[model samples]
Target: MTSPEEALQQARATYEEHARTCRQCHFDAVPCPVSKHLLRAYNNARREQMRANSGVR
Candidate 1:
């Protein structure tokens, strides 16, 4: 029952926390794979939502 916006906010918060605790020297920042993965996931979810909504109309 949770809205997508709420879920995204939760995800963003979690990402922020991870970034804060992330080891810079141990890992790359600008090219972080986590951000790339999350972006793909978000795009997929948005596409699915649009597809479902279009079908409903």
Candidate 2:
């Protein structure tokens, strides 16, 4: 299993890469469907990492 930190890093990288290449994400106030999904994933990963650091389940 990937560590929480690694997972968060991967999720962040994926979201950042998509945001960089996706014109809709850059130009539109609302994110595109894929961008939304990626953002959710990144957020989830961040939360997981925080929980892990705090020793919470």
Predict model 1's lDDT versus the native: 0.59
Candidate 1 Cα deviation (angstroms), residue 38: 0.5
Model 1, residue 37: distance off in Å is: 0.2
lDDT of 1 at 35: 60
For model 1, the superposed segments whose C-alpha errors exceed 4 Å read 1-29
Clashing pairs in 1: none
Q: Tens digit of lDDT per residue, candidate 1, span 12-43?
A: 66566656666751275563677656656566
* Candidate that scores best on TM-score: 2
Assess every candidate by TM-score.
0.48, 0.89
Least lDDT summed over 10 consecutive residues: which range in candidate 1?
Answer: 22-31
- Which regions of candidate 2 are displaced past 4 Å? none
Q: State which candidate has the highest lDDT.
A: 2
